[model samples]
Target: MPSPEPKLIAGNANRQLAQAIGRRMSMHRGMQIGLVDARVERFNDQEIFVEVYENVRGEDMFIVQSTSNPANDNLMELLIIADALRRSSAARITAVIPYFGYARQDRRTKARTPISSKLVANMMVSAGIERVLTMDLHAAQIQGFFDIPVDNLYASPVFALDILHNFKGAMDEVAIVSPDVGGVARARELAQRISAPLSIVDKRREKAGEVSEMTVIGEVTGKKVIIVDDICDTAGTLCKAAEVLMDAGATEVHAYITHGVLSGPACDRITKSKLKSLVITDSIQPTAEVKACENIRIVPIAPMLTQAILNIWNGTSVSSLFDTATLEPIYEPLYPGLAFE
Candidate 1:
């Protein structure tokens, strides 16, 4: 028997990305996947309501929602949307969460704090989510919290292609630096991809989102340093590491981060900092100030995401989708219609 067509239902969070994914999928696969009509809106009292206009019975559904800034609201919307699809007899429901909220709370450091990542996983499972697709989760171990299959996509292939193209002439002088110890593996992987040196920023945080002092652990002096990280919330770590790298006689500094949760003076800090540019993926929707920043460049994840969806639907290995060692043409243009600032 022929399988039903796949559909993408988007929540308010990162709608642009969702739309881009839908369009890319259709364009590349001859209308293989489509954007479904749905209303995810707020009531008069600010309560959420979702109504799927399409008959999704026995359909393969992918719900695109980013549990970003308005964490609670976005999370609720995804859960409700999944519940609606499950109730409508969808064959399968995969939650595509580009930016997972509560990911930072994977483990409890304090006495009373909860393992919110696990809690979110439980909520999604209870809401009838059969699978999860997310990108560069705050902690890799967050995947273990879920009972269902989880695909934690990497931004390295996306970042690597961009770096190879942008820094075409300076690969010999380029160095990939991790902003902190936690990101060493990510930075190291990129360094290996582009055949560049690796560096790490040794820093101590007084509290979350605050960096006190930093020291460089590798030979970054006279090198064009590229700091790699998963999330850039306040832009504090990137800015601080850039400053410390400059103080260490580094030639130039740039950052390629996966999720740009640029909130609260992040734009201002990036503008005033010494870093040449901060590249980020559109995992989360960019705000007005984030779009207005002169030094911030956004690389769309839609093409890779479209390919992943195709791979998943075709029963191909999604794990083999992201690779940059050969530096082959991953995608001709990262984002077709989007302009990079």
Candidate 2:
């Protein structure tokens, strides 16, 4: 007998990404994977209201929501959705969060502070989510906070393919740069994939949201540099790092980040900075300001996400989808003519 179909539901957080995932799954599976109707609205006084229209009784459910800007509202929306599905008798609920906000607060640095990431994890479990599917968490340790199974996806494969395609014959002259010491591992992986050298930027953080100084630890002279990072909030670190790299005689500096949380003044800073371009995944929906920035390019990770959902539904391992050794070069754009603006 065939397996039962899984229900795909999305909130207001990232409808475009959710729809793209649904469409890709439908095409790949040779059957429609339409998103289940779910209304996520607000009361006049700012309370959240969620109503899952279709019956989810005993069905496997995936709720796609990225708690991006207005993080609290979106987070609450996801929690409510999970609770609703649990109450409706869904067999299992998977929270597909592309851009997990508050992930940077995974650890406490000061005298006394909360680990907000752990709190978020607990809330998901309490709301009755059985699993979590997310990408490029700010801190990997955040997974340990969750009791339920959490599948953390990577964008290295996607970025590697794009770098190979775009950089082509210039691969030898390309260097992968980690914006800070913390991202060295991620940068090394990409560098290994593309047969490029790795470099690190030693930075001192005087306070939150600020990088006081940066020192390059590798030779970037006359090389095309690609700064690799997980997130770019204000574009401060990236912008400063790009300036330092260029000042060190690098030909050009580009960035490939997983989540572009391009908050206050990010687009403007990127616009005026020396970075050649900033390529980011569609984890967080770009705002109007981000779309207007010519230096910014948004890549679609929907195909990858769709395959993950399909694998989970089929009781298969998710890691196989991104196994670099066996993965082929992605020749075609996942979403053709996807307008950034």
Candidate 3:
């Protein structure tokens, strides 16, 4: 017998991105790809509830959600949805998270602090998710927190294509920069793709949400610097790094970040910063303030995500979607019993 049709479900967190992904799937497959009818809402006392009206028994289910702002609420919604699907007897469930929340707290920094990312992973596994598909995780090692198969996609392919089109004929004068030492790998990949030089921002962080000092490691003199990172939460690091690069004689600075969790005064800071433009993917839905920012531009990742979903459905290797040399998929299971190999 043939396999059941793939079903795409969206939560309240990022309906726009989910719809875009559906549209891309439809365009590519020449068929209408509709989201399963579901209701995810809260009661008067802020109690979350979820209901899946359509039949999904024995179907390959993909739940599209991004645990962004109001992270706790959205996270609960996803878990509830997964539980509902599992109870409904879905063949397989994949949590398609474009932006995984609590990813920054992947490790225990303070002696008594919690590794919240691991807890979140455990919660998902307990909630009945069999597999995970996410993009641009804050920390790559967070995959180990899950016992199930995890496919961490990269946005470098999308960013590289955009850079080529936007900076055509001027690639020689461009330089890819990592905002801090931690992001050197991400920056270097983009640099290699564009055949440009690479630079690093060596910084000292005195406390959370603040950078005490930053030093540029390489030459940005007379170059159009492009800073690449995974997330832009408060915009503090990007803005400060841009200033430092400019002070060191860089002609212009732009940032290509995957997740734009532009909370607090991020938009304001970007407006007042020395950066020419902030390019972010539509992994997390942009707020009105972010959409209205004159210096910010959004590139849709719906097409890339749609392709990944299709690969998963077809039982093909999703890693082949990206350049293997630059963006390798983490297939080795970090936990013993959950190995995909």
Candidate 4:
């Protein structure tokens, strides 16, 4: 017996990505869901308004919105849509956020500061989101911020497969490099799967858009280096790290980032950098400027997400879809009341 399809909804942020995901899911189970034009014009006092054209009563709803460009607006749109679905008697509402925003600000660096990621998580919970499905969050610990079931999908398997297919014979000579020490865990996982050596680029950032110097922590000399990261905002660190790797006698330097939130001259910098290639996921919609870059390549993850969604919907194990080398499957116990609190 086939399971009932979940309703798909899309907001203004990254409509094309949402449609792609919808099409992938629809190939198995049909859906009548469509994107509603969520464009809003500011009033004199500055208030936002939204309208949804589809009926979602008694249905399992998934609001697809990526907090990418105009992150605040996209976040608000998602929140409003969730609230609307809750009010419309939806059985379940899952926030399908491919690229979660404000994830970098998970902690307070200064006194009297707020943890923005926690606040966003709280907002989603308050907005009546039953679950969250996001990919390659900037900080993995951000999952703890949400009270709902949060699934953090990995884009590495997708990229690793693409790399193996497109850049064949280079795996032996290649070394997966982490853009920073913080991303060592992620890079190591990718490297292990690809059967390549691992390296790290130790970089110091004085401020936003500026990196002082970079040091290679492993033997990358004469090796093809592939830097992995969750997000690339300014491209400053990535380009600088590529420069350092090249100067350290690397044969070539490439980068594979999950989310290309390439704001403000990021594409331009990558185009002018020493990076051999820059591969990023379509988690965030690529702008015209990003599309114009010759070195940029987008690897699709829609098929992966669609399969996971189907597995979950059919009461099958979704974790079995990926090759998790070192990362353990963090699942909650079903029998929680059996003596374990």
Candidate 5:
């Protein structure tokens, strides 16, 4: 007996990446993928409408959507799509979120703040997402929020491979700096892989969209500092930390963040900052602003993700799919810089 073909479907969050994944799976004939627009629009009242164009009856479906900017809309799109698929009798629906939003709001900082990350996870499960496949979440513990089998793939291998390629000998003098104490585990893992020293950016994020006070916790003097974090939203934290690293005598500063959710003024800050190069993964499609920065480079995870997807479909262990590869980051044309007064 043969197995039924699994379906690959993508929402409007990131079609380019989805297409690349589909292209990789094209080798397997008889496998069909459905791409629905799944974009909701607002009328007068801030109401949302969702439509699923394709039929998913009794089919194994993967909904590819990255909850990036306009995070709420993209998240609703994914949930509604999952609901539609479930109601239509899809055998199993998997929400493949490359960039999960509301992740930073995982814990309650104050007495009454909501754990929105857990809310998002619960919503997906309620919407009929039987499983989840996502990349480096802002908080690793967010995996526990999911009741379904969640595969949290590491972008470290991808980032580590690229760092070794371009940075080359700099790895010997490298100081992997975690932008905050919370990210020490991830930073230390990368540092170990590259045989580099680990450092910490002991800082306090006083409030959202605000500058943080950064203190270099390790010896970064005269070393090439490589900052690692899961996401870079405003670039405020990273840019400020870069300055602190330089002041601490770091010869050069570079960053390898998994998701470049580079929102307002982030590109400008990166372009004018002290960092030599900023490496980001294509987990979320870089916004126009981010793409324009001269120092920003994108490393494709299509191949990495393709392998993971295939492994999932084949009932194989997804752990080894994150094996280190020898690939360099891809440098695309920079966006035109607008000078500030």
Candidate 6:
């Protein structure tokens, strides 16, 4: 006999991404357990309310929520949904947080600063979340903040495949660059995968969210440089790095980011910057303004997330999906109704 399908719930945050993951689950794993009938609403004073209309008693439950913009509201909505699931007698509750907010606050640099990421993790466990699934966390050590099982997935394989496909024959002319010294490891992985040279934008920060100066570390003259990073909020660092790379003699500069937190003036900066293109994942739903950016593109990770969900259900190794040989290069775009061009 076949096993029972795991039920999925979508919070208000990134509902489209959750629905896409559900469709891919049915298409790839043949599991029809799509988004559970849940409605999240607000009251006159802006208090949140959630109702689950499905019969999910004793079922393995998963809630797909990305604590993106308006982080507090989305985070609270997730906790409330989890509480509802526990009250409904869900056997297991896994939070599929495609983009885990507060992850960048894993540690404190100044005195009396709260480690918000740890606090968030504790709240989730307190609210009855048994497991966590997130992609390309800003800091990997944030996984240690949670007491339950945590799966931190990477978007490297898809990115590597896309790079290999686009730069088919001229791999030598391509260079992978980290927008900052912190991201060199991530950039090096892609550089090694494609056998391209690695570079770093060595930058000095005078304060939080401000860079004083930047200098290129490696040879990037006359090469197509691709900047890789986990987050792109405000696009200040990204745009500056592009200018520095161009000044250092890069033929062109492109960016491959995991979470596009294009909060304020981000799209405008990218639109006016020297970047040839900016490729980001659908972890955070694109706004109308983001879609209007000419050089922005979105890649869907529903298939990969679906496989990870299935593996988690079966108690298998989700890391095995990273095997490059079994995967094919994404020559064309995956998600529809986004700026793919």
Cα lDDT of model 5 by residue, 304-333, tens digit: 777777778789988875555322211111
Model 1 alpha-carbon miss at residue 335, Å: 10
Give the CA lDDT, 0 to 100, for residue 126 in model 4: 98
Candidate 6 local lDDT, 1-341, one digit each (tens): 22388778999889888888888778766657579988899999999999999888888888999999999999999999999999988899999999999998999978999999999999999999999999999999999999899999888877877677666677789999998888988888877777788989999989877899999999999999999999999999999999999999999999999999999999999999999999999999889999899999887887778778988988999887665443442223432222211
Error at 160, model 2, angstroms: 0.1
Error (Å) of candidate 5 at residue 154 is: 0.9
Model 1 RMSD, rounded to 1 decimal: 3.2
TM-score per model over all chains: 0.95, 0.95, 0.93, 0.89, 0.88, 0.94
lDDT measured at residue 221 in model 3 versus the true structure, 0 to 100: 100
In candidate 5, stretches whose alpha carbon ends up further than 4 angstroms from where it belongs are 1-3, 28-50, 205-212, 325-341
Off by over 4 Å in 1: 1-3, 207-209, 325-330, 334-341
Find the 10 residues in a row with the least total lDDT in model 1: 332-341
Clashes of 3: 0
lDDT for each candidate structure: 0.87, 0.88, 0.88, 0.80, 0.80, 0.87
In the range 1-341, model 4's lDDT, one tens digit per residue, is 21257667788787788787777776656655344334433457655566656566777777888988898888988888888889877788888899999998999988999899999999999999998988888888999998888888898876766666666756678889998899999999988877889988888778865778788898998898999999998898899899999999999998999999999989889999999899998888889998899999887767777666666556676677566321222111211222110
| TM-score, cand. 3 | 0.93
Clashes of each: 0, 0, 0, 0, 1, 0
**Which of the two, 5 or 6, has more lDDT?**
6
Please give the distance, in angstroms, between residue 288's alpha carbon in candidate 3 and its true position after superposition.
1.0
User: How far does residue 56 in candidate 6 sit from its true spot (Å)?
Assistant: 0.7
lDDT of 1 by residue, 1-341 (tens): 22455689999998999988988877876755667888999999989999999888888889999999899999999999999999999999999998999998999898998999999999999999999988999899999999999999899977888887787767799999998898888889888878889989999979875777898999987899999999998887789889999999899999999999998989999999999999999999999899999999999888777777777777788887567532234466552332222
Clash count, predicted structure 5: 1
